[model samples]
Target: MTATPGTLVLAGTPIGDLADAPPRLATELASADVVAAEDTRRLHRLTQALGVRPAGRVVSYFEGNETARTPELVEALAGGARVLLVTDAGMPSVSDPGYRLVAAAVERDIKVTAVPGPSAVLTALALSGLPVDRFCFEGFPPRKAGERLSRLKEVAGERRTLVYFEAPHRLDDTLAAMAEVFGPDRRAAVCRELTKTYEEIKRGPLGDLAVWAADGVRGEITVVVEGAPDPTPGDLDAGELVRRVRVREEAGERRKEAIAAVAAQAGLPKREVFDAVVAAKNAAHGAPSEGKGLT
Candidate 1:
């Protein structure tokens, strides 16, 4: 790494309204020694809107060229080039291409930062009406049905709300798989063309949303799903609950949700399942239950 004063700055463009662009973004675009954009034409339009003309070099840094361009951008940073990274919309390196360059810059002891702007992730998340304390962002599920189903299987028992970016074309199938895996009654929201003209937010059970998507919609889409509820032992089938707990544990569910789902299904409280699990363990070790004599 060559000695340089330059830093890598990721600037978020607006997800919709051009006015949502942060003032600092325009300053960065104008002052940087280089601006790497996912789409140079879009960047030009944005720059024009801000009345800021870049005195720096502008290069296309998209998926197809990101791997090849990271090294060169790192070299520029080493030579004191103030490189500004921007995507077509939202932050770079978030299901975007700036991650590789950011990682490389850190490895070289180069400074890295961001010019925070609008994000569809937080925007849709805040509007989701689901638990906000904890959540995960799944960029996009695979386009293929089998692959998407397999991916949904991995997150079946996740307790935190989940967010996903998806193409409008595959929205129907993606939602169908979600309903199948997460249960038809799970709550979710479909946010489309957010912050733009004709913005629409549809909130309902996953099953209903799947049918709506089949009608064919357009524009960018963000999906938010509610987390799984806590478990109750009495809601479970004694034997089935225990078996499900084991199978789910192996498949990646926390001991708690597996137990909870079993309890819920059996119409029992969670404590009962917890006690049963403990008793089963003790029996496996040849230990007699103290309650046996009392009964």
Candidate 2:
């Protein structure tokens, strides 16, 4: 018996416009041996738009079905089925389902690939006018006040731009939490209904944005935040550096990242940062280097 070649295509459909669907996505959908979609109805709508009926089996692989569908999908992939995964918008597994399937495929050494599509991250980042060279995506923060604050505290000193997807109803509370945790002066932009007619970008300090969102805004929302400002050079001091680094490190930042951040803020080289960290470690153990400090 001949073995079939197995492949997993991670396809991207438009977040809005049907015309935005990439050619590869349509072709893959038309020929896939198994189409795993977040929503079968939306998939049908998409197929209708492309005028291409999938000539393969279709399966719903949404949040509710994700856990139950994985083993079955894995078995099919092991049998060399060309499983194509598509979500309702943008890409799958990003604030959606498909991560588990992707993880399973990787565990079994199955090939995985993507068909590029629209993203609220890039769209909001582009429109936010905030620095985007480096960024971190936080997805949606916790809905409850305490949990949300705890989460925000985790990224309080993040120097890279931050992106967040928020719901219309929670906009005010989320923005308020961001202001309190990230500081009222933090620069941020609120992007709503991207790629749609009512698309809007509100840019200002977090305090102002919080107030605006409090009045209630509708449609899809994407938020972009400017990173923490780098402290000026020559502000070196072991005290503040240790405080900042230890705070963030305790909040979940990796040691290496914490050191780098302290280095950036102290206007010190990474080597200097490393030396400071070592000295602090030594001090904690009653071995502070007497020669390392200023003469």
Candidate 3:
């Protein structure tokens, strides 16, 4: 005889304040048939603080062992055991672990659902002065400088606000790189500590933020960068395109690369931009003395 399948619960825990822990989370913790937590010790502390006792088994489900433990959790679900998945903070499977188990559960046609709670991404975006009507979450940047810069370059022309998760220690270097690629004047926000007592939010140009972060930052970090500004009338004129390409070339980008980047940024075809630059040079034109688009 086949056993009844159980529900897979993806619960979001408080990022900082314990009071933010939802009552539903408490009830779920107390009654779940199996609790799969990213950190068993942290889970213990949380349960203690909440004054709740689990009626079923509790197991560690983190990055290290998630691969091997997913099947076991799936079996529990298949056996009709209520499996509750919770991360250290925020929602599971978001720059955290839980993807494997959730995917397995879905493959088996087991019911999967989430208990909505506090989110760092949305919170930071809301606090950020930049526009958030359209945005994208770019998880962590690559650790290496070259790779990180390449990744940044890929989105250089992105018009939607960008959100990123970065380690505190690497904040300065990351901001510096962003300033280089995204321009020193690009606006951004640095959200730290979140809902904790020491929570802090820093908003300014990327260049200024880089200098501030150089002094050192602590706790969790989320960065929100304003998207590339929209081009205005005459923004794509031949003189404007030449100036844009030259600025990039002066920044050490190859001529070809600079032309391509300028094209993308101005929403123009590369051939048109390249021809414009060639035409400007042939006409003995140097950088524009003054123009609405030069800055």
Candidate 4:
């Protein structure tokens, strides 16, 4: 006879204030048969703060060993061990290290559940004063400058609000890149040390925020950027379209990407924008127009 598959519990830890830890988190931490933590030291501090001692074995399950340890944890689940996974703060898988274990557990038909607690994503979004009805959590931008700019460009025309997790040190460069790609006038919010004693939410245009972060920011950071604004009908003229494309190109975007981004912002077809750009170029170079003009 096969043994009953055990459950995998993903518990959310407090982002800052220990008081934010949910009661269910402590109970699960105390009762789980096996506890996996991103940082064993932090986990010890957490348990101590909550006055809960694990009745089961505790182990480290961080980025370095996540791959190797996943199978071992999965095997334990198959053998009916209750495994609880927790990160240093917030949910395990959101820019953290629980995705592999969760995916592995799901593959083995193991029961998986979550103890929802404080979330930096939602907290920052709520405090951002930006549209929260529709949004996407982009996690973290690429660390390298070129990759980071490329990533920002991909979302240059996203209609829904965007949320991202970034390290304190890179906040300035990231915000500057955002300003360049999303436009300096785009509204955004930077949430720092969320739920902590020094919690701060800086709200302003991307250009201003970029300047503000130049002096450096400290603590956990969550950035909320307003979505691309819908262009008015009057704003879709041929000259305007061409100018928008040029702006992107000037900011290091490829001509193709610039055209696509302009098209997305105008809610027009790419072909239409391409034709407008072609017509503008033809007119400038004293050549005959090869395509239809902007309507």
Top TM-score hit: 2
What C-alpha lDDT do the candidate models reach, one value each? 0.87, 0.85, 0.89, 0.92
Candidate that scores best on lDDT: 4
| RMSD list, candidates in order | 5.7, 3.8, 8.0, 5.5
- Candidate 2 off by > 4 Å: 1-5, 233-257, 268-295
Provide backbone clash counts, one per model. Answer: 16, 0, 0, 0
Give the runs in model 1 whose Cα sits over 4 Å from its true position.
234-295
Q: Mark the 10 consecutive residues where model 4 has the least summed lDDT.
A: 231-240
- For 145-186, candidate 4 gives per-residue lDDT tens digits of 999997887677678999999999999999999999999999
Q: Where does candidate 3 have its weakest 10-residue lDDT segment?
A: 286-295
Q: Which scores higher on lDDT, 1 or 2?
A: 1
- Expressed as tens digits, the lDDT of each residue in 86-111 for candidate 2 is 99888888898989999998998888
TM-score of each: 0.81, 0.84, 0.81, 0.83
Q: Give the Cα-based TM-score of candidate 4 against the true structure.
A: 0.83
